[model samples]
Target: MRTWLRHHQYAFLVALRRLKVQPFSSLSNLLVIALTLAVPVLGASILLAAQPVVREIPTSPEMTVFMKQNSTLEQAQAFSQAVGKEFQAELANVRLVSKEQALKQLQSNPSWTDALGALPSNPLPHAIVLTLHETPDLVTRADSLAKTLQTRDGVDSVLLDSEWVQRLAAILSFIRIGLWILMAGVGVVVIATVFNTVRLQALNQREEIAVARLVGATEAFVRRPFLYMGALTGLLASALACGLALLALTPLNKALSSLAQSYGVQLTLSLPEFSLLLTAAILVAILGALAARWSVTRSTQY
Candidate 1:
């Protein structure tokens, strides 16, 4: 086992030396892989960055129902209950904001506190804020739910904040579709890159390959060095891609911090993202190697 390991290490060093001899050739291959990987990574990062904003929109885009001045507490509670039942699956939760709470909120404002305090009666009406669930069809559901709530007794009006929800849903949909398309396109590019690189390697080593076959070297033995070369090239490309991602993320992280602070959210890419990225890199290398091996094997046979 020890001797076998030493021979493998020697072979790897031989491959490395061979790769180093043709510096521009390896660099070109690496650049191609980096370019291919960058597209999907950029698209995915954008999608991930937009997630916090998209999620917050659903929670914030709530329907505010104002009660008629004449409506009693019992009437308001009953109406809230009906809404809760009707949208049990659609809504996250609902609560009736009392008149006093409304007054307190208004009073808390410095501009209106002094003048509002002078009024003999609290002019604020009871309101219900209906929080909706996170669903793709949230906007349509909100509209339907609003129409149902508008007809309830003692309900003055149902205001569905349609604009925000609609915009958010549209943004999320676009991100998802665009990311998938970008990923698919990147996959094709990587395959083409590996194919071209392998084709060149096979062409250049045709005489050597013929000599190896005459010496009784198995096809796998002839193919092994090229496979290793392809994998190494891909690995180098992935490293460059990771470096580029970090470079791109520096400004992105700063912007995300500012956005988080503004939106009162802790928006940061978690550890899982790093793991997935590493896995993606390794997968790119393995897939590229397999593609190169398959191409060479098909073109050079016993």
Candidate 2:
């Protein structure tokens, strides 16, 4: 065990010494890794940042069912109750706003209050807000429910205000697809960057590797140091990426916080995602080192 430890310790020292001797080359490789990793890291941040905003979206574009001008209180109340009973299974939440409540809401608006002072009677009608379970069947179910509401005695129009919601959903879908494509493209670049670095390192140390092999060192023994060095490089690059992300976020936070404060909210980078990014970086390094090993082995004379 002591002998094995000494061997590994020697290899690790050698790797460090090589980096010290080739500082510029090592920095260039680290920069390549950092640039390549930045794409996925940024992509992940965007996706995470959208999560809270997406949750808030359902409230913004909900379906509003308005009663007719001539709608009697009894009839509107009965209709709302019936719809609630029928949709209890599929609905997420339902709210019935009576004409009196609607009037009070409008009166809270200065312009509406001034206009109401001129009118003898309230022009606002009772309304119902319906929130549905987010499912694949939502649109079809909502359409059918809207048709049912339209034919009701007191309903003015079953205004399914889902147009904006649908548009938002489409946009989010496009973003998700675009993010995946971006990740895949950048992942390929990261692999290539590491592979080239490792290949070059192998070439420079060919004489040392040949001597090691001539002394009966196994391929795994010869490859271990390069793999460890590659892993360390990737881990360092990921750390640099985290710092870059934080630096970029400073300006964005100032701008976003101004808007978010009004909504009782804040935007932030999900720090938990750094662990995932680090893991991805490590995997990329291992794969790249193995690829380099395979290529070098095929061409190596020893």
Candidate 3:
């Protein structure tokens, strides 16, 4: 164990020295890798930040059944009660709002006060806000329930409040798929970048490798430095990418906060966990290094 540790320690130092020997080339490679890695990091951060917003959306009412202008508060309340009784298994809650209550709510809003005050009488209809139980059959049941409510005598219309939420969910699904494809492409690029770098280093030290082999050095010993070099390169690049992603998110968070504030939503953007990001970076680095080492071994053997 001690001998293995010493070997790795020596390889690690050699890798560091090799990078320092060509600072400009190392920096250029690091920057390219960082930029490539940053794209996914930025995407992941944005998705994490938006997770809270998505969670909040599902907690609200799924649909609203509006009553006709002539519908009385008693009729609206009866309808809400009937809905609660009929869809008890599928509905979480059903709340009836009278026209008078709707008018009061409209009056409470400063923006709507002027328009509402000009009206001779309250033109607002009664409504029933429905909170649906989350289930696999939620969409189908909700649609069926809405259609049933629409045919009722006092119901003017049944509006699905969760339609926009559904659309947003679909959009997020697409974004996730796109991000996965993008990450796969970026991973390929990273592996290729490391492979090329290791190949160049191998070619540069061809005579040295040959001399080591002639001296009875094992293939693992010969490949150790290049593997360490690839890992070190990936590690540094990933760290830089994380930093860049955080910096980019600062402005985005500010913009998102401003937008949320303007819309009167209590929203705050969150950063990705450091431990998670670091673990991912390490894994990616190790994978990239292994790929480079494999490519180098194949080429040298040929």
lDDT of each: 0.78, 0.74, 0.84
| Candidate 1 C-alpha lDDT tens digits along 76-179 | 88888987897788889999998988999898899998899799998888999999987888777878878877887788898876666667778888888987
- The candidate maximizing TM-score is 3
Q: Residue 172 of model 3: what lDDT?
A: 83
Off by over 4 Å in 2: 49-62, 66-108, 111-140, 147-157, 161-180, 273-278, 298-302
lDDT tens string, model 2, 4-41? 88878876776677667889988887777677666667
Report the number of backbone clashes for model 2: 0
Whole-model lDDT, candidate 2?
A: 0.74
Worst 10 residues of 1 by lDDT: 263-272
RMSD from true fold, candidate 3: 3.7
lDDT at 239, model 3:
92
Clashes of each: 0, 0, 0
Pairs of residues at least 3 apart in sequence or in different chains that clash in candidate 1: none
Best by lDDT: 3
The deviation in Å at residue 50 for candidate 1 is 4.5
Each candidate structure's TM-score, on Cα atoms with residue i matched to residue i, is: 0.67, 0.69, 0.79
